[model samples]
Target: MSSTNRASSDDEFIVVREILSRLGDKWSVRVIHEAAGEPIRFTDLKRKIERSTPISSRVLTRTLKQLERDGLVTRRVYPVVPPRVEYRLTELGQQFLHHAQEIMGWTMEHQTAFETARREFEAQTTEQ
Candidate 1:
């Protein structure tokens, strides 16, 4: 193991934590994933995102706003009879998705290990 990994300064650690806290957010990462490729309308995104895990419309709106503020997503509005709005991933957001995809893949691959560990832990605790 690298010494730097173990010995990052307090300030550096906090910075890393903040970055992870944002990127690791439940809605943000999924929102970015859904926004990838083509621009998505709010209603479509809401439907698509909830196909697996349900997210509140309120939380989804808040997540999108946060992402826009962070420069990770772009919000485009159109003038029409009814206002049309779409969200797309910014360049930075695409780059983030590449990393996020890797992490997600790794987690999927290792999930069985996690389940096994949890079962073992529970067994040990029950015996104790």
Candidate 2:
């Protein structure tokens, strides 16, 4: 292949990897899922996510910021006495969530097969 072609391929690979790395994060996925229907307050989101996975306030804040930077989530602050902040998914985020859900469904459907493959692989490795 030409050097230019190789360089293009490498750049594409890097971009895809970066995107996957961000979206594949557990906290990111959970946050996206939680922010699906309506805008959610920070504390409420934290509480809901913590019910399944424990996350610190700092980590959650960082994740939200990253998501916002990536244009996947939006943060809105209400001008009230106590101040209010809410997070919601953007259109792009919704599209991503739809694809992620499909991938999740596929994984669930093949979970048993995955487990069996892992067990076989482990057995073979241990035998050697």
Candidate 3:
């Protein structure tokens, strides 16, 4: 397996890694962003998040459920002829999003430098 697939052995930031993993998760961030402002139904969320359609419904469902369990998202179900389920970010979730978005801003700001370094490093490796 590639290094990316290997489990991290460094314990220095294991907790940080675990926490960061959730935000970096393929669906979690998108789902959170999509459900940020107001309560949204599953189908609407699925459509609002770009490229999320490729993520299996099962995976998305599980992600939403886990987020709910973590108190990051509130799930509401309406008792109607056809049950309506919606999700919205909890207060805790909003706080988390604030920080996460801040970090994302930092990354975006540095993305060009990061990409430049990556390209330089790759060129050196390929030449060697």
Best by lDDT: 2
For all candidates in order, the CA lDDT equals 0.88, 0.91, 0.83
In Å, residue 17's CA in model 3 sits off its true spot by 3.6
Backbone clash pairs in model 2 (N, Cα, C under 3 Å; residues 3+ apart or in different chains), count: 0
Candidate 2 yields a Cα-based lDDT of 0.91
Clashing pairs in 3: none
| Clash counts for all predictions | 0, 0, 0
Q: Distance (Å) between predicted and true CA of 121, model 2? A: 1.1
Ranking by TM-score: 2, 1, 3
What is candidate 3's lDDT per residue for 1-128, written digit by digit as tens? 55654555455368567667878887777788778997899888877774535666788799998788778899999999789999999998888788888989999999999999999999999999
Candidate 3, residue 44: how far the Cα is off, in Å: 1.5
TM-scores of the candidates in the order shown: 0.76, 0.88, 0.76
Runs in model 1 with CA error above 4 Å? Answer: 1-15, 126-128
- For model 2, name the residue pairs that clash: none
Query: Which residue pairs does candidate 1 place in steric collision?
Result: none
Give a tens-digit lDDT track for model 2, residues 1-128.
Answer: 99999999999999778768876787888888988989999999999998978999999999999889888899999999899999999998998889889888999999999999999999999999
